[model samples]
Target: MPVVRLCEDMKEHPKTSKHKCPVQIISLDDQGGLALANEALSQCLEQGDVGDAPVCLISIIGEQRRGKSFLMTCLLRQLQNQEDKDASWMGSDDEPLEGFEWRSGPETVTKGVWMWGEPLWVQVPQGKVAVFLVDTEGSMDLQRQLETSIKLSVFSILLSSYQIFNILSEFKLVDQDYLEMFITVAEEVGKNFNLYPVQHLDLLIRDWQHTSTYGVEGGQEHLKRVIKDLESLPGNDLVLKVLKAAETQCYLMPHPGTRFTRSNRLGDFEKDFQDCLKDYVTTLVALPAKHVRKDSNGHALTGKQLAMKIRDFFQFLEENHYDFSSPVKMAETLANMREQVNRKIVDIIKGEYSEFVLHQDRDTQTETHCLNISPTEMQKKLEEKCQELLERCRRELLGDEQQKEAMVQDVGQELRQMLEGFMSTYNWRFKEMENAANRTIKDKFKQQYKGYITDQGRENKARLQCCRVQPRKMRQCLEKKGQELLQQCEEELRGAGDRKQAVLRDLEQELTEQMDDFLSNLE
Candidate 1:
């Protein structure tokens, strides 16, 4: 990826250079409907120098006029410095922050999700990753509809790997309520879709009055207190669950100083506020790999993959006509999507199994006779084949390990039942073939023995007539003939046993060949 710096003069650069600025990736139509800036978002995610690289999105969300845009601007500067390995990331303090538009006013400035057009290329142990800075429109504006605020918050959480939940003064009841609702929605969506919805959540308390606790240590203390207090409450289970689910952090920033707030410049900010800000931004960018966006399985996502997921989520909402009016409605939508995914998994397994059976049948048709494998060996091969199918299905399943395992077990049971039926049919056919072969051999031996006995009787009659003159000689001849007939009968019985053994041997060889073919096809 290229190392492109933010323009020094936003006005002149817009006219003279190809350097890009933050662009809105999501917006609201005049009719109050959600509008996705597909082309713009695609440009930022797919067409840039960061193409196909794993991405780490950093987004800031808070109430209106809470310096979210300004903070993103600071983050942009820090990112630039981090990329260049320069200590002068803050640049000239007199230079006004020029990334995302920010000003001290009650009115909202950013209307929707705005993404910096160019990604900061950060090198990590795994090579390089792209980091995108996002500025979301502030939430809880009285002028905006409740649904709008919810939508913005949801989108922010969905798009960012590291989200800064900017708050004024300290964490309050209202913040808790809003956060709970947002986290609930996120959690629901995540559970249904098998996604890691919240990766890192940073509760950034602005203008903290507590002088003793200022940075991370203080922030952590305050968070524990708040959590403990909420734990005593009756209905904060979801909030607690989400907190535990994500990696949480808190930072208390001292007031940026009155002069800096008035001038909207870095030079006038309090030294302590500046120091804290630097620390926060540095820590965020220090280990980009740690914050890389991942799926539920903790596999990092490339830019294009991330873009597709974002688009898919928004498209689902749009198709469902979700108003984002209530968490209940969100839950219902997610449940529906989950069901669809579940059905898709079932269908995939069914299709794969069906194909496998069909292939086996085709191969079976080419065989001249039944492959006589022992029942034990047959059962073992069938079980192995079933397991192979289960593993294939497991890969197609999406969810946490526990959920995936449950689904796999269910599929496995179904496969075993099917194989049981198949085994029954095979065993029945093999038994029928064996019984028929035995009967045919018995009938052939019976006919030959009957003919031999008749011939021996006629020969004995002729010999008796010829030996009538000598009674002793006749008796001796008759005894000898009887002994010869008995020996011949025994030899025939032995030959029949040998023929049965040969048939069994042929069947065993055929079974081995069939099993080898089946296993090779599986591989």
Candidate 2:
């Protein structure tokens, strides 16, 4: 295996290496660098084989030529030591597996966001994690504008789980401005993006010196004071809430200076810097990895989701003129999402309820055969079917409680309408059945009258009695039986109507009850 550097030329990636390609994943440029970075990051993720491990991204940002890359290298080495005591520096066939290069110059080298070739699988107190390192381009560039600086700063902070602000001494005016911008935008982040992991900032002060008279507690205290002072600035209330001093850890380190080689090799770094850095790296390892989305369930979002979120975030910024704290824009986004869920709920209701109607119609036909079918029995059957469909509709609801409840009501109302339609059709079917029963009774009466006439003609010898008395009596008796049959048919139709009305009522009650239960669960 051979190590390849990210943010470098792809042609330079070692062809023979199967295990490593430590090359520049992305070098952000105007035309297509971001797209390339996205692709490279994707490929890197695939190659790293993170397995089932949770991923933690740790990145560095600060002034240009401030050894931010060197600091990242130091942290990686220390973390590696904690990962495996007997791990070798060389890969297969003596291939170099060392980290970022460091030189004693005041010129910027690393550009844009850079990721390590492989993720470090380390054990934290919580659990094991696959850690990726990001080295961002340094700030305060003469070539770039303040706007560019702000964008890069925001991107780095949003992307990383743990960020190292590698300052040579103190926070510059630009740094303060960048931080303030982050604070302001962070409030609106949740409305639009999956702001995961509650990013942690660590101010690593290098080339340390005591400038404060109240530095009785040493560099950590001084760091805290700096942060406190930043937080105390006007309009810093939101920033302080998001990036509190308690959440922000601070570490102090001396300049490697002449004691370290310029070769950027791990073996050549100063022992003192290594020792101090070990604890710093350990602190990072102990911190758990974050998900971009706050999971309501046990599962967390994967690396792919983070990548997609980053893409969408930038797109949103571009379209909205980088207006981070735009309530209107956030609200619009939410409205669009809610609309989508509403449409989904509609589709689910139509499909599920339609299927239910097909089954319910068949069942009603079979059940109608029973002359004594009670309203209670019909209600039980309707409730069973309605309850099933209601549960399916409940599952279709998405987003916040308000949106979910609104969708539940929408489903219930639509379902009730469907039930009413079914009842109307059922009433019409009952009318047809009643008509058919009446026609059968009339036909039976005609047959009986013909038999009575044939009997009277055969007894012609008693013509007077047969024609007058018997015919009159038979006609009267037949008319009375016909009336009774019609009354029975009318009674059955009325009973069927009552049962249909009962089923409809039961369905409406069930829908309302289920809607209440679903909304309560959301809370």
On TM-score, the leading prediction is 1
State candidate 1's TM-score: 0.75
Where in model 2 is the C-alpha error above 4 Å? 1-21, 30-33, 51-53, 83-97, 123-128, 138-142, 154-158, 184-190, 211-220, 227-232, 258-272, 288-299, 310-523
Q: Spell out the clash pairs found in candidate 1.
A: none
Give the CA lDDT, 0 to 100, for residue 63 in model 1: 83
Q: Mind giving the per-residue lDDT tens digits that candidate 1 earns over 158-263?
A: 6788888999998888888888877876776567545687888999999998765688998988888888888988999977776555498889998999898788
Question: Could you tell me every candidate's TM-score relative to the true structure?
Answer: 0.75, 0.58
